[model samples]
Target: MLKHALLSLLLLITIHTSNAATPKGPLEILRHSLVQEVFAFGIRPQDTNWFDIEVSTNLTDWSRLATALSTNATAFFVDDSATNAPTRFYRLRIPGTTVAQQQAIWTELRRRTYTIQVERISSSGKYLSADVTVTSGAKHISNVKDPLTGEAVADFDPADFPSIEEIFTKLEAAAQTGIYDLRVWYDPKHGYPTRMIQREISGMNSNVTELRFNLVER
Candidate 1:
């Protein structure tokens, strides 16, 4: 099959934008504020495409709030229902770009078995690096070892290093929430993600994942 490896890191940041410059790109939220149970967002669009505004409490399930055509360069959206949920996230997306495109790649990954190396740096500055192996027909990870010492490392929770399938889940969730700018590079041969960077739009947090693969069997 194939061998796969990952190096991931999480960082937190603050993003600051200049009020004097016109924001350009996909639909972007220029500003957001909450007052007296009402949430308001200032948005700007680079193009005239129709967009859907969605809200989610959990990243996985999103509820449509509105659909509007962006004929103008700038607009404001106010959510009166914000008070109903203690925490919520909002995103604006074009009609067909979220789940369908990602599903194709996730499906291919499930059919292959590979060994992977995982290195992670947390926002708190903790770091772990290990090599992992997965078998196509197995229910659990086949192996995890220190790349340097060649010894088993027990300090980690298996959850820390996700399977290819789990990574896809995260990708989908972030896409739905519309909190991050997702950038991905896929292996040309195996059609799997080689690198992914999720940078939060509001500049609050970011995650970067890098995967390197080695084929051991078919």
Candidate 2:
């Protein structure tokens, strides 16, 4: 009987040792801070799993922020949208979750007030561009110029210039139609499109538009 008991105890110890060696999921936060109104945080994650990052202002309604793959090393993250919020909270959700719709980035941008310079190039080879400033109540556009001439547009119609909102609308439509060759790049911090190119390949409309945006002031 004593020999049998010793064998059973050895088997249990072996199982526990094996289980402890395995890495676990759900990343752990190491440190976090708000610098220059941006949320900067560090996390230690298991190499075996991916994590969904979520953030909130009230801590009750969480919004999916981003997804990250763990490398078993310390990782750093930033919340550029934090600049507009007075209070912010964040967490690392469980593995296997997916990123939410693309609209999240636009939502982040709505909270900010900034000035951006836009450069436009179109199929007609003529484009009116300007530096645009947006605030709480009104939009201020200045330095309106014709890129084709590299001169100030003496008689510029604001309606002829596409705003950021309009660019996004065009992108969304292109995405849904599945007919245009579209390539877009976004600002890492603000999540707004920094560059976009759309070429209509269907031969129905051979319009190609290229837009480049640069943040001038926050």
Candidate 3:
């Protein structure tokens, strides 16, 4: 009787240890913003191919916002609608998998980039305003263009305003012709740029421009 009891105890211990070591993908919230009011979470791609983003005001009740697929690595989600409410909660649920969701994830990850809100005044007393959005490593300028003999119209990076060094070179040139003022704001998490202001102060023709980058989804 004593030998049988010892064997059963050993078996239970082994089973419990094995279960504890089993790999199960989990989701974790990395960062969040209240003023921007965005919440972010990362989900590792596991046996399931698709996951659902469920948002809730209270933890007990959740509303499904989006169904997304995963690549080989972890995937990120940013909830911008959090800005509208006083408080919000989010979670990632592995409901099911689908081929369409897989394709959509690829497309979304490809298109996810940055947007720039540009406002500028030229030395000639002319004002140029525009929005620039970067998609798939290309920049689409909304309102402004280059008038110089040879200069880039726009640039893009996953992080900040594309070609920041090039922009500084232009700013210095503008200052040489007149006066230049530059200001920048950076996201604390990644140390990437978020907002900027550049002013050309050469006299009455001085042009002031502002550019705000969308650091993340919000």
Candidate 4:
């Protein structure tokens, strides 16, 4: 009976620690690891200088998933999006930050089965903010929020601004134009963006659009 009790206590401790924002991995060095189908983990930003996420099939011939991914948010890039290889491996490094970084930041955010706030800002000032939710793994602005009270500004509404998924779509489309710059910051725990900015830098006008996400927890 005592042996069973001790085993149960150990099992509970394991379960609790496994879901921690910073979960331990089989490896000592690689912090981010898989927990079931979901890939979730957190990394401090200081360690993310020029950081990147890379994947491999047999732990060799690594290909970068993203570069320059802001480590402030927990890292959560999906590993199955590419070819569905037999075995997949992932590693986070701080040596490169580039287009791959943007890809890595946006990938894990397909949806966490939750909702959050999206704030839009520009040089002129704040434009709009809304409480947005995920539907079928896509973001939809449910209702605008009150800036003062931080409550939903409306009941029934039209989601005017782009959703996170939509923003990624726009990002991919705009990449070909070669006329803009995108900078993003996300929560490293569940992989939610805290802020994203896109600036049209080709011409003199230099219009900047920023989205800030405030996660709403139940």
Best by lDDT: 2
The model with the greatest TM-score is 2
Q: What CA root-mean-square deviation does each model show from the true structure?
A: 17.4, 17.0, 19.5, 14.9
Error in Å for residue 130 of model 2? 0.4
lDDT of each: 0.51, 0.58, 0.44, 0.51
Alpha-carbon TM-score of each model against the true structure: 0.43, 0.46, 0.32, 0.44
**Per-residue alpha-carbon lDDT of model 1 for 1-218, expressed as tens digits?**
01110001011111222332643334556676666767776676443433456677766787556543333456556667666676677766554233445457556655555665556544445455654566663435444555556676666677767655566676566554443233344444454454443434235654443333333334
State the lDDT at 85 in candidate 3. 56
Would you list the rank order by TM-score, best first? 2, 4, 1, 3
Can you give the lDDT of residue 2 in candidate 1?
10
Off by over 4 Å in 4: 1-112, 137-139, 146-160
Please report how far candidate 2 places residue 202 from its true position, in Å. Answer: 7.1
Candidate 3 whole-model C-alpha lDDT, 0 to 1: 0.44
User: 169 in model 3: Cα distance from truth in Å?
Assistant: 46
lDDT of 4 by residue, 49-130 (tens): 3445566666667765543333233332333343344355556554444444455765754445666677777776646677
Candidate 1 minimal-lDDT segment of 10 residues: 1-10
lDDT score of model 2? 0.58
Which portions of model 2 show Cα errors greater than 4 Å? 1-103, 109-112, 147-149, 157-160, 201-205
